[model samples]
Target: MNLEKILAISGKPGLYVLKVQTRTGFVAESLTDGKKITVNLKSNVSLLSEISIYTYEGEKPLTEVMQRIAVKENKGQAISHKEDNAKLTAYFKEILPEYDEERVYPSDIKKVLNWYNTLQAKGLVTDEAPAATSTSEEIAAEEPVKKAPAKKAKAKKEE
Candidate 1:
């Protein structure tokens, strides 16, 4: 799934899809309400693609974490974010055992789950990489490859 265009603005309720780019910043439509709003450059906006969770090894990108959850849940919605902290922690541990409890708080886990559900509900979550390859392969098979022209040999220098 591509989250590059999806954003999580601080102090905002739900995720937003980036729409038109403005001179100052850009306009975005809320995934929950479908209302458009202009987000200024100074605003605390984070692309979902840029978010990451702290882990024992290092930080794991949100995309990879979401993909793990998607696979674990069979591409279905994860447990509700409203679930208790213990439950949430357990679930996240099962998915990412090395997640740093100190750095990655319960609230962060909830947000990730909630965002995943929202994205899945909007049909934005997808296993498209493989499908894209198959389509590309099909196109390649249908089209013939064009070969580059061979260069002419240069004449030998005279003694």
Candidate 2:
């Protein structure tokens, strides 16, 4: 359920996976076509991991919303994003009843469904909860060890 490197670039149709960072920007591969493209820093970019949906009480993380969709669809593909706006809104309501109707537009719902389906097709969507402790341990294992710098010894003055 880690969406760490997944991104949504404005003016782009589908999602992208962040591949590498450059001096000016970063390289991203499209989720739909796997084509690599270099995006400049001025372009609008949003990490899916940081996206959240507006709710009546508060904002809900995109990951949690995606996870709920996974459970509702049993980790299968959701309804087509091209479905009617009314239908899409109905479906989204069932998924998140508290979603702020005024704030959460139909287009946003469609994007989420479309993104979820894309991830599902890639076998990246899972219903299982993320293992917190294991993830921390794995991160620790992946991190390189840092060595302390040697201290210089003081020079003794002549007696």
Candidate 3:
């Protein structure tokens, strides 16, 4: 469910995974086609983690919204975004009840649904909780293991 590297580049179809950072910009691999492309720094690239949906209470992170959709759909593909606007809006309403109807347009809903479907197809969206070992493991991540220094080899005398 990690959307940290997922990006939605404007003018680019489907989602992409951030690959490498270059001097001028960065390289991204398209999730739809598995092809890499370089994008300039001036390009409009939106990280999925940073994107949020307008809600009545406030702005809800797109990650949480996507997770909700995954739960609702049991981690399966959701309804097609190509469907009619009314049906898309209704489906979106089910996913986010407090979504601001005025601020969130049909196009936006379509994008969200489309992205969710793509992620689900790639097996990124999941409803199951992450597994943890031990009964009282309190930490979210385990500490990094330290590596031992390499031993120096003795130099052989010339014979």
lDDT for each residue of candidate 2 in 65-131, tens digit (9 for 90 to 100): 9999999999899999999999999999999999999999988999999999999998989665554
Error of 1 at 152 (Å): 30
TM-score of each candidate?
A: 0.80, 0.83, 0.80
lDDT of 3 by residue, 1-159 (tens): 778889999999999999999999999999999999999999999999889999999999898899999889888999999999999988988999999999999999999999999999999886544333444344424555578998999999999
Superior by TM-score: candidate 2 or candidate 3: 2
User: Against the hidden true structure, what lDDT does model 1 obtain?
Assistant: 0.92
RMSD of each: 7.0, 4.0, 6.4
Instruction: Name the runs in model 2 displaced over 4 angstroms.
Output: 127-159
Give all candidates' CA lDDT scores: 0.92, 0.92, 0.91
TM-score of 3: 0.80
Stretches of candidate 1 exceeding 4 Å from the true structure: 129-159
Q: Write the per-residue lDDT of candidate 1 for residues 24-121, one digit (tens) a residue.
A: 99999999989999999999999998889999999998988999999999999899999999999999999999999999889999999999999999
Best by TM-score: 2
Runs with alpha carbons beyond 4 Å of true place in candidate 3:
127-159
Worst 10 residues of 2 by lDDT: 126-135
